[model samples]
Target chain A: MIDFKQEQDGAVLYVDDEQNNINSFRSTFRKEFKVYSAINAVEALKNLKSYPDIKVIISDQRMPDVTGVEFFEKIRHIYPNKVRVILTGYSDIKAVIDAINKGQVYRYIDKPWNNDLVRLAIQDAMDLFDTRKNLSDKNESLQSAYNELDKFVYSVSHDLRSPLMSILGIANLAEVDVQDPKSLEYFQTIKGMVDKLDGYIHQIIDHYKGSQGKQFGDRIDFNKVVDEIIESIKYHPSAQGVKFQVNLEQSDSFLSNKMNVKTILSNLISNAFKYQREEETNKFVEVTGTITSEKAEIIVKDNGVGIKEDKKEEVFNMFYRAKQDETGTGLGLFIVSEAIEKLAGSIDLRSTFGKGTEIKLILPGTSE
Target chain B: MSDKLSIVIVDDNEIDLMIGERLLSRVDQSIALTKFNHSTEMLNWLQREDENSFTTNTIFLVDIYMPIFNGYYVAEQITQVFDAFDKKAIIYLVSATIEISDNRKLMLNSRVEGYIGKPVTVSLFKELIKKHG
Candidate 1:
């Protein structure tokens, strides 16, 4: 599908110790391309240096000082983007074979080559050269853009956090300076606002960290991490009266970024408990999971204050809370959703206003 | 005197440098810290100090991006000057940068002892001191 319609002005250098071989190429390709002849690798290199627009170089396998394979290998380091090809006779079959494999010879033609085929091969090499150059140019631009964004983010975060630090410091000072009860309350509120700002900064940092994918991933015991989280929450005085039950499907060997998954699950489980129904005497949460061939399905069910069906979608949005009584940044569910998405997972919620809420997560498994 | 860890924090913002210094002092009173708002001054001070008597137990807390010279260049100088400081003068990059690659690139430098994200809390500071102290 190469468009040969364009005036192909590029030249091809033909190198051979024998004058007859070089003459054959010159006579064959002189009409279509500007064919340049070289006696050996020395002459070929000289021609290459002089004529930078030489897009392809066809050389004979048998040479006086160096074989075509060795010559191409040396040239590859110097002119890496140049397309190379080897022409060999029946006697130099092994040399040509080695040249093709080791030197990345674009194409090989036997001693007696068809004029049409040789022309076609040169055309193909020119097209390949064009494609590779275009791709390399695009790659360079993309890398520059990536670096610029990285620089901007680094400076922005650093600049933004410095002011936030000043705000928190002033708040800390005011907290001690204020004596009135209502003024103290206002300072406390200011402290809370500063803390929320700190949380947003932390979110930006975490978001940047998560963008790195994972640096280290190993087989982690999910049950151990889950148990530790559960134990930590259970020790909280809030869990004094609530009856807790755990039905864990043993050995949840998931191929995931453990820290991210832990964050996601801990938030979901804790939220389940936090929004418990006031009317229901029995405060309970159920966590369950099943692994399929392609994914791991996890369900966190709680008999707590449930979300109205209309607001189910809103919970995952940033700074979203269902009620005024809730004291949270509302970023937890949003962070959880981001974490789950990173694992190539989907989340769904089922809830009744006063009954309970159930969250289903389907995360990618180790499978082709 | 021997037990105290000498440290320097280089940042552009005065408030951040003060808070960082305060947090470090709160964590451990023994930590004698020198703060610099300009990275150039810090670099010059480091160069001058290296020619003089620079201790082996000193550590640097640097912000990655600064005017004129950045943390990367400062880290490069630290690596060369502190040839014998394999376990000393750890350059812990403290910034709020969200670019993971930037952090990763810094981590590639052996002189960069550790990385702590910005708005570095007292809790994290305590953990860092415990680990490196």
Candidate 2:
């Protein structure tokens, strides 16, 4: 019912074995953009070679001798950046899935394609292809940067740790003779500073390691991971006098990365512990998980210094801290936000300023 | 000479070298585990030891995070020597923090025997011995 004219700047190729399909596509899309049609995969390949500017290819699945998936898989090696879409029937769902999993098809439209939706999907595919190409170039640069940084870390740690350890070792040896209060106090302060620097180095290593994998995902456990986190934070100085509550409604297993989920939880929990009221107020943290047909949800609620409603969105931004005295890298929440997005998830924040805050993460689950 | 496994580990960290020796000793107490806190000494020793003079079962466990000669460099050298001297030797890399995927790819790409994560517990060393034996 909806009308869509091809707004693709470059020429679009419609490859189908049916002659009627070629006519239908041309009539529907020729108003706003140039359309190219091929009755078979051979002609499509020829057209691809002839027209270098063809940015998108919409191919039908049920072609003679070769299916859309096979055709695109062959084309992918040659025109690696070309946007590919499959027009398949409802009966060919399994083949469509195979095409997607093999990375041949970008999107699949049912045989009775919605005219507007098909056009829009094709346009979106082109835009996505361009974005992926740019991202690939960026990834290459990041790879070099990662290697250089790793080498730098190894060198710096090797050069610095030895001298620092020797200095500290000699200082401890000398401490046996010194009995002055001020001298000992000064040595203690220097030792503290050195330890702090070492801790920062470890943090840098962890951050570098965490940022290395940009690939989307794998299977992740929610329950056992949550248990480990609770155990890790139970003895923290800030968590004193705070009761922890946990509730889970999912099958302890899910298909996602455990590290990304852990990152999100750790950030939220750290913030919760950091901003707790110092008075005789009842302090507690409640973590709950629920899985529905659509998505998995995690709610982290803490009785802490909640942000103002207006500042909730800004908190997720990098290096944006509400308190000037808060000693944090500020990259923690930013990394959390990035991880959530990479998983195709959304985060919602609710807070009552000066009372409490709650963060909810809704992530796509395995059911789809 | 066949009764004891004479192994040499090259790493800059005294703790890591000590730990490696301790772990390897658990596998075979008769094992003559020598530790080198410098890579140049390691490469020099390997060069001087002739194939017939040294035991064929000798292994070189090298750390990848050293200052001068890294595990990759040591691996390349050993492979070259194996070809030139017509001696068969195994090189295993150890590192604390390298990703498993990256380490696997590097080992496969460079034609090395294996890699073990650092803080190498005693059990892992035993497994290595069992597999290599």
Candidate 3:
């Protein structure tokens, strides 16, 4: 008896008014399923409460006190995940529909139960229960893993920036006391390298903060975010003679991830400002966007050193630089692409060799 | 106020302390500067301070991250010792990579003037000198 019960695939509760029927169900399917027998509605509730592992329930439709559909409906809220099946000899279509709608029944068994058919139904129900349980369990672990990665990335990037800052500080001091042109140039070269590394670390931090779902739902004010980024870039050397223009049409209620949007816009705008031609009068980056209830469309256009047609495809790849220069870390567009993926959005780029570059992005947002 | 300001620099890292000294010296060669690599030592020095040592023109630059007592603890101890002085020295919090928590603490502590991210630039040092030097 213990061996047969141990071989069972899943636990199920059988509810019927007849003692004879309960005895028969227990005898026939006891080998295949771990059957829990309950004679009346009250006992059925007791069995369900006692055996939390009860996944599928088979209850007779007609009873002395209550109907099977009624019993299933009563405990629907308490045992919401349980797979319910109604059994009855009298075929009542209305009752079966009601059972399916309110009681959330999985299947209907005829008045005279078939041993073979009932066994298959119970097996199928157990399979569905396992699937649902696994899915929810997987979701929890996935979320926690993402959170762990986010914190790890943030701390590591900040740690990397400390030493880089020291080198930068050391460079600043070296620049003042060193009189020779050769040594000054060497310090300038070292400073440039440190600056690039520092910028790369910043991108990593931004990417991690932007990806985590827990960081979402920050109301994005395009004009305000743009204003802040532009204000900051104005102090950088790349802002020289670059006219920054922002034109956004968005309502007050548009909701989206603020950090991702900032990452996307700043990288795009910074790229435009950094790669401009020597002709001072023609340098300008025009940022235009419109936010709707379902999506946001943005265009960043700049008259800068445009990407060559061959290099355009690889521009979004990590560490792929179109221009071999000391100004950029080659991570601006790569970070933008990562943020886009996190937002589940899309981006398009167009550029000519020496004329300019234009980038368009479509991002999802909600007015609520 | 005196013609030359007295600057106090505190950081646990030896290289950072040296760099701070050089940076502040380059800003104004005549300015009197003091450096401390430990927060406890700095606190002990404050305890030994007399009326003439604490002046209105005195400036303190404290590193935020350290070994035993972090920069905020140092700031708290300094406030306890010097908040009532007639010539209160202005304190500025400095960090290699500024953290968000540091910003919140800076806002809460009105004693801290502002946060400066390292490596500190010559222009930034010159700006501080122009303000209170």
Once model 2 is optimally superposed onto the true structure by TM-score, how far is the C-alpha of residue B3 displaced, in angstroms?
20
User: How much does each candidate deviate from the true structure in C-alpha RMSD?
Assistant: 6.9, 11.8, 5.1
Fnat of all models, as shown = 0.30, 0.00, 0.70
TM-score of each: 0.68, 0.49, 0.75
Per-chain TM-score of candidate 1, chain B: 0.85
Runs in model 3 deviating more than 4 A are: A1-6, A14-21, A37-112, A213-223, A243-257, A279-282, A286-299, A337-350, A358-366, B1-14, B25-115, B121-133
Candidate 3 lDDT by residue in tens digits, A119-205: 888888888888878888999999999788867875665567778888888888999989999999999999989877777777767
Q: lDDT by residue for model 1 over A170-224, one digit each (tens)?
A: 5555554567889888877886776666656666656555665563254445567
State the TM-score for model 1: 0.68
lDDT of each: 0.75, 0.74, 0.81
Better of 2 and 3 by lDDT: 3
Off by over 4 Å in 2: A1-217, A231-241, A280-282, A308-310, A366-368, B1-37, B42-63, B71-133
Error of 2 at B103 (Å): 6.5
Better of 1 and 2 by TM-score: 1
Q: How do the residues B1-133 of candidate 2 rate in per-residue lDDT, one tens digit apiece?
A: 3442467688888866766676565557766677789888888976986776555465778877687887788778777766765444667887654344465556563447777655555566677677654
Interface RMSD of each: 3.8, 9.0, 1.7
Measured on C-alpha atoms, candidate 3 has an lDDT of: 0.81
| Tens digits of lDDT, candidate 2, A1-368 | 11233565677789999898888888877886667889999999989998887788999999887999889989898998899999998899998898899888899998788998887887798788779878999999999987898788765554555445444543443354468988888787776566555544544555555565554344566666778877876786677888788887876456665567677777777678777877736898888988653568989998888899898888888878788755565666787888787668999999998889998989885531
Candidate 2 vs candidate 3, TM-score winner: 3
